[model samples]
Target: MNFILYSDVNDSSISASLGRPEYSYYFVLKAYHPVLESLGRVHVAASVADVDVLYRQLLAAGEDSVFLSFTPPQKTPVDLQCPTICVVAWEFDSIPDEEWDSDPRQDWTQMLARHGRVITLSSHTANAIRRAMGEAFPVLVLPTPLWESFAAIRQQQLPTPVNPGTTLAIKGCIFDSRTLGLSADALIPVPLTPEEEAVLAAELEAARPPALTLKRRFVIARHYLRLWLLDAGRQQIEPVPRVKFLSNWYWEGVRDLLPDAVHDWLERRLRAICAAQPLPVAEPVPLNLPDTSSVVETRVDGVIYVSVFNPRDGRKNWHQLITAFCWAFRETSDATLVLKLTQNDLALYYSELMTLLAQLTPFACRVVVMHGYLDDAQYARLYQAASFYVNASRCEGLCLPLMEFMCSGKPAIAPDHTAMQDYIDDSVAFVVKSSEEPAIWPQDSRLIYRTLRHRPDWGSLKSAYERSYRMATTQPLDYRRMSEAAIERMQHYCGFSEVQMRLSNFFEPLPKVTDVASATDNASC
Candidate 1:
């Protein structure tokens, strides 16, 4: 019954490890440790090296143990004496085919089938695993547990709101071009190699030429025609004119006149043309940012919005979020965006982020980047100063910062997709609309990299900003209601009690290991 918790991010420096994967494991461990303690002894291994040590110790002592890994299965050691459990936060529907050869999870699945079980954050992921592994495979759904520690922090009164139309006060480290090698005062484009320049030029040229063909034109016409017909039909059912007789008659005649073979030909032609279009190439953008210091203790008068994420990951969609925010609030001087980026080397993505921000020039709204080291208290203060939490991510395994913000009684502007679907709703958040878009599986980059992820509609996000601004400024009652609902939902979904119950249920069905030697022998055999 002894459990050894293995997490790679555990060994990371506090500030650096604040990234999603690290802090996610940190919070889960915080929630599960006490519960597991009541069951038996619990030990933590922050790195592979630590896990190796624990594995050896357990083997030598012949102790009944379970290895619980908070990282991907591939990252877990293949050889272990005890039954292993991998907790993963996969955001995609399935692993890519190309990744099958290079992905660590390929071996990890075999390990799981032989001597372990899998735990996922959502049913969406559970379904995906079932699709990949098999319906009969054992995969448990364990949502990321909320941090109960926040209760003490939440007891503190919220900071008073700054006066309208004045600088909103934010106390944190500001990341800029200086964090990397570039000078903050200058707008220098990141130098591109000749090869990179050539690739960029090719991509730009490809984008410029219209790829549409005659078949594509026909396909587009057919699609629009179907949509028009559907709309007209819906209108015809309405009280006033449920039947647009003349229009419907004319369309029906046209549809009858065109043979199905002609439509099929058009479809094939369109497909052929689409298939010929060049594949999108990943090209680096030129980096630029306005002069700013590493530390920011500034004030803003408008409604403050906040979003925290690691810029290194594309799923965060930080670039799109910044662009949408700028476009939404460009002419307004009364709003500010506070981005609390969690990464070890701010310089690694400083240029890219600044370059993205630089594109939103001559804007009235201010963008404040919070980076550098932050203690728990400082982090909590950053959350307290924000009026709303914003996330424009393409997907999430389990967004901890968004959960933490909700737990602190703050309303969010986020899309109700992926893990967020578990808690976000109209009652608690400004739900942005989204559609499935092509993406790469974050893990197993070498495997089927082409996958699909939710793409939030930029227009919807822009409107969310506008609506949230109005709610924060003119509709205090509604805003407070949403804040309260957010806290309530977090408590119900992420509470320690709920997590403990789920864990208890999950473990109850497993056979108890009475003899470590016997279990190890069986597993080895």
Candidate 2:
């Protein structure tokens, strides 16, 4: 059989597509290529049109062919001539079953139905498809074969509860929290006192915007009142009862009296007035973060925990990962968090990360942010440097970084929800607790909440960090046991032989005859 694989991103474009919606498909496709070659000749098409062109050429030559689209179901071509199978990486509990954005394919059921079969990284994704399509839908859960790829790293670097020191080199920039001089006072100005507020209020009352009319002033006042009341209700700020009462009265009695257009116009004007006001503080002093395109090295020691992710991806939930780690080891000096960021645009996450670190000020535990690509040697060094892998993700579509680290024998601090449920457990990881919450499909332009995703409990994650730290410091034997279990789990879960066998069976002459339960041992999604 001739396997024609296609993804929107290729090696030439991967650097620019680092955090794109379907960028991971490139990595997934790369990992699947060698294994697919074992089954048959693999041809990677540059575009969707090329897929059918190649398929026809193979067909004319009297060769059986299949097109594997490494993308989400919504993006897969439904009008293709060749038999197509979408390789989906999904985290939600339900597949999109309704149409939106005037695109029929946005409803995944239509796309998957047209394709007739699907391949996904996790059992969660397969179950979601089955929920939307049917239990009889031919969906194969195929994780990227990765366990065998890290054999050299595993052999050279044995798992340990602590790292003496490891130098991590990257071609971009690195931010070490220890050297950042973080302080909440530097990021946020001090709150005004009641007396000072009274004086400022009088000055503000006398210096209103020149164009402010009585009606407009009332509108602006009402807007501020509503914002303050909402913030108060959310416990984000202190409440002023009089302002809350007035806002509630206006909302209940006056809001309905105004036409929506007028109300919206007033809100817009209010926003403009607010935007013109001076900020409480000037832009927090730039951290003067490293701005370089050359390789830089940093040394990390002690019980080093590492996590790799694109900060732009909301599913990563990196905010809690940092806070939980800092809070868990606020007084400890040995703990270090090495965040290997995959996104290329540093500006996207720089300020937000710095602000978060400042807010959680005075913590002794270190955080090292490496924002750039790592070559094979550097990446292997990173893999070897980790004492444990950390993931505080809200959800995952088969977290490849977490799996790769585990395959290299590093235990983890991760939530056992979504795709991680297949391999993460007490034996191999310090399981962080989570619960389902309503969420929208990532591609749904209408932003309709059609599915559920996990929300990792902050407290559970913090506790996991603390427990894992204690285990690393005091229980070497137990740590080694967990480390061994991590490797064993991956060997069963995504080892090359296991994944290759599953693929061979999936592509058999009478495909769909293979029992998924037996293939996956009823473990993965």
Give the TM-score of each candidate: 0.71, 0.80
Q: Ten-residue segment with the worst summed lDDT in candidate 2?
A: 516-525
lDDT (10s digit) by residue, model 2, range 30-78 = 9999999999999999899898778667776767677899988877887
TM-score of candidate 1 versus the correct structure, residues matched by position: 0.71
Write one digit per residue (lDDT tens) for candidate 1, span 270-372: 4432122345898866545433334455554457788988888778988878888888887887688888777766558866776676656757776877765
What overall lDDT goes with each candidate model?
0.69, 0.85
Residue pairs with clashing backbones, model 2: 122-525, 123-525, 124-525
Cand. 1 Cα-lDDT: 0.69
Q: Judging by lDDT against the true structure, name the best candidate.
A: 2
The reply for model 2, stretches above 4 Å from the true place, is 190-289, 510-525
